[model samples]
Target: MARASRVAALAIAVLFLCGCGTVANLETGYRQGWKNAVIYGGVRRDVQSAGQWIDHSWTWGKDLDIIQDIGTVVGVGLVGIDIPLSAVGDTLTLPVTVPIAIYNNSTNRASVSRKTDAAPPAAAVPVNEK
Candidate 1:
């Protein structure tokens, strides 16, 4: 009976240790995944904003206007811009600083710009070669 009890105790201890390790691993993976989602989502939003700015600038000209919307996601903050006016030559310029939470895996913050002169100089050149 004593031998059987000892074996049972050892088995219980081993099971407890294995369960603890599994929990730790699961927690670590969850944290990493959450961090990645925040960083990637921020980057994706920035890219979309840049594309929209380009298309709007092209269609609207210089009369572009943008309204910023700020919110948080899973403790990470995000900023969104809504451009209502898209008319070139209107001379609309605004400077905005947006707060974003970058994941621990990332070494730098995301930067987004909405401006009139983002196009390359080569693209602005006339079709007729000088």
Candidate 2:
């Protein structure tokens, strides 16, 4: 019985350390945090700087991305002891997902190049023909 319980506890801990908490936090509260920062917090230089640091320019998407990433790190750190691994995986997913989210979430929904979009767009006309 004692060994069985210990195994169960270890399993739980491993699950917690797999970044589930970070992904949950991201899915649940990110939009609210973003709205609060942009709407209530307003434009502060510090906020803008953090925004630029994450996404390379001070658009709202970038600003909210900083908040999102920080929350992911802190949330996963609190819940997961193996934060280095979890943070690494979470960080990787964001840059790829976030840019696509920004592009798709826009009113225009225009197509944009993504880091993993790998395929180069076809030329309007073949170079040999031109």
Please give each candidate's TM-score.
0.19, 0.24
Write down the RMSD of all candidates, one decimal each.
23.1, 14.7
Model 2 compared with the native: what TM-score?
0.24
Q: Which residue pairs collide, candidate 2?
A: none
Summarize candidate 2's per-residue lDDT along 93-120 as a digit string, tens digits. Answer: 5654465445446623443434346777
> Candidate 1, TM-score vs. the true structure?
0.19
Off by over 4 Å in 1: 1-39, 60-130
List residue ranges in candidate 2 displaced over 4 A: 1-17, 29-82, 108-130
Candidate 1 has its poorest 10 consecutive residues by lDDT at 88-97
In model 1, pairs of residues that clash are: 60-86, 60-87, 60-88, 61-87, 61-88, 62-87, 62-88, 62-89, 62-90, 63-87
The 0-to-1 C-alpha lDDT of every candidate, in the order given, reads: 0.34, 0.46
User: Candidate 2: global Cα-lDDT?
Assistant: 0.46
